[model samples]
Target: MGNSNQKLQEEKYENVMKKFKLKESLQHTQLGMVRIYNLKDDNNYSIFEFHKTATTSEEAKLMLTHYKNRKCYNNDHLTQIFFISEQHSQILCQDQTQFIIIGEFFYNNIQNEMKNYIQKNNSFPEARLWQITLQIVNACTYLETNGRNHGEIKSKNIYIHPDQSVKLIEYNFIYGSMNGYQKALLLNDFQYLAPELLKEVKAKKSSPNIDFIKGDVFALGLTLLELASLNSCEQYYDWISKEVHTDKIIKANDLLLQKGYSTLFTNLIYQMISDVDIRPRFSDLKEVLSHFENQINNNVDFYSKYQMRQSNQFNIYNSVYTQQYQRPGQINQAQSIYLPNGSY
Candidate 1:
């Protein structure tokens, strides 16, 4: 009976792999080697993330269990884990080989998108920053309500689709913690680590017994600052190293003010990253965001009219300059110009 069960498992593994066609190697993410794959019939596409060196069946099983339990809750900002293969577990434990997990395919991440946008535009737009920050906070609130904590909340883990929608990924770290498994490694970018977690790590504790939800709030605060300043976490870390707690807050607020971010937004970020005992709950953060959303809606018509007037002025200037430079026989043709969309 044991031999027959083992044979069936092997056959099942082979069958599962046969259904997907490996397309091409993608960039190496922190999780593992990401690759694109399509169904054999070319009807569907998915992302296959393989971790040959670091993955173990024990860790994979923990992740799979958590995925199954939490799969019912769906939000636009959370990436969906489509399937996890039991065959990968067999390979990891029995064959002492790699394992793979599959998830929705995303073309870009927030880190890369921000970098590219800054390179082309020289600055991050306030409206887009508010939208992205709101989406992330909304995701955090959803997880909080669902009794889950996103242990890792960094820009690299936030995926952005081509349509500019955002989704948070990489939940294995969170699930591993719930299973009482300590992460073998620590992320190098410690800027996002909450102060309490850092203190625990400095004390050489095996696992930081801190409130992870609050830790996520701290990370989101820094993320908002990074977005507003158009600077990477590394740059923010360097700037933060020179200041004490109060000085850090002052500096962040001043920098954001120079960038034209409203005082309300800056204050909310400050409150979120404040001391663990004093940090506002997710509900408070959501309320603040709601106020901003309403304000934006109320001012939409004013902004539209302002932009239209600016466009008309630019066109008139261009036409007058062209008329002055043109020869006597040349005809001045009116050109239709559309304003660029800024809703993203």
Candidate 2:
């Protein structure tokens, strides 16, 4: 559409190809589909990005630039990587009466970032993984502040940085609770959605008027619970989709009082997903986690922490950060790192 927009897309596409040491595709994405590439260069660029829908490359450029330059994300302090752009003219394919190029795709970094997290710490990892999950709450908070709802807060939509800073991508699904009702609502299922949001759409769906923002709050709760469980197991790899061992959350809270932790933990899980009226907010969770950190570092007995650091656990107690990104000759800088809970 505009010369500047066209140029940005071309540069971003080429930028990624060179970085990943891959050949650029002039034509890909069969009929309305598009191609994505990865680069392995000085500019690792945006980990990977999706092609955006726009009238022209220039329009796409405008959209991408705004997204990349968002000051609210704390991205103002980090180097930027463009994640999307309009499609190529030659690849535009549609009804014979209408031919329009749509968008371009790039191999993104979130997958690789997750891979690294699983890689360096699979057998036994640090609490960093847990900390990153907590950051998602902050991301959701940022969105809420902007009057937007990240309709989908699944783990994959979140991008974890090597710097311990997380940037949330994929606003394609961002909506307000009111908007969610206008369209039949569906929670991004990672099994972490609040029970109300996680209800079977076939049988019951959320009314958009309801404050689905709590879905994000509930997801945070499950994320916290999931991370704590994994850490307690001694090895991160011990847990997986197949390793899910608790479901008492969807059941009644009365079941919790019947047992102890098996119940208390399960009940907390239920509160996160099943009971929206009483669901804990992100602010509430932040307070809880702040206390958790104090408990862990000070060895205080938390009324809620399932445990005060893993017991008889070599992994959680023994792990440390592994430097994942080191430029060829970059000098190391000393700095303290902190999670949302204010712990390093």
Candidate 3:
């Protein structure tokens, strides 16, 4: 079977080269960056990120064999990540609700670069992923709007694709945490947790309380804030605060609270975080992000100002995909102004 998989992998490489009208670049990624490229039928390219220590799960092994032959959403790079088949056995850990590993190696370079970029360019993903983020947010909102709640949201659990698409993976919890151990519980890392969950997780107070659906909205709002900071001038919000363990998303609400959206985010957080009926429900969160999107778009006017900022000296993005300057699309066209990340 391993040999069969290898044969299939080689065939994919050959096929990719032919379709893309190119050869493998064999670029060096950071240690553990194990990505396999797949040539799209024509003029298109995609990649798969796999775990170094392939699991015993026969399904992941099988999926890998003909993976290149499959048709993916194409827009979503999350397709690159690995996931246990819902029908298969179960998720990996106790606390984690769902588990999927797209690639063994993710953006080590990008994370470091974003740190410097925040110091120089003052943003993350430079806007490429921002467009993707909105799609994910909309998807989450649609879930609750349609009466489906995502249950939890975390940066590590979400995938940002190079093609500007988002995949909100790791849903093992909706069925119940992997291995039937929901008691593993979350901590500061519960970024998408609801107000009541926070009360429990923080005080080390455990309970059978499960209202994951409404909780997802709070997490979704926090996610927007995360995507926003990827390029906001106030990129320091999460890091400067207690972003370390987001089991309860303390910093997310705090940052928004400080952003002068105090009336909006703070009230939302306070209500949602409430032990009583003050907590907003999932539908309420959908309204909040919708309003938030419109609020930033109207108040900031990013795209218009960006278009006008186009020039030659600094050449604030003279081309469709700018280098040393321009990056296409209004990554996060929010209203808040930020200083450069210093890379320029």
Strongest candidate by TM-score:
1
Estimate, for each residue in 183-259, the C-alpha lDDT of model 1 and write its tens digit: 31243334466666665555557766688788788777777777667775544343224222433543554456445
Off by over 4 Å in 2: 1-20, 23-46, 55-72, 75-130, 155-167, 170-192, 198-207, 223-247, 250-271, 287-344
- Name the weakest run of 10 consecutive residues (lDDT summed) in model 1: 335-344
Taking the tens digit of each residue's C-alpha lDDT, what string does model 2 give over 1-344?
55576677678766545545333444321112333344445333333332434455555555555554442344221223434344444335621111122222333334355455455664212234334544555556556666655554444445545454555543432111223222333432233434444343334544434565777666554543444332221122111222222233222222222222222233334445435665556555555555445433453322233322233212322333242111112111211122223332
Order of the predicted models by lDDT, top scorer first: 1, 2, 3
How many times do residue backbones clash in model 3?
Answer: 34
User: Scored by Cα lDDT, where does model 2 land?
Assistant: 0.40
How high a TM-score does candidate 2 get? 0.48
lDDT (Cα, tens digit) per residue for candidate 3, span 60-113: 455444333222323232233323321122246422111222322222223343
State TM-scores per candidate. Answer: 0.66, 0.48, 0.42
Ranking by TM-score: 1, 2, 3
- Of 2 and 3, the candidate ahead on TM-score is 2
Please give the CA lDDT of all the candidate structures.
Answer: 0.56, 0.40, 0.39
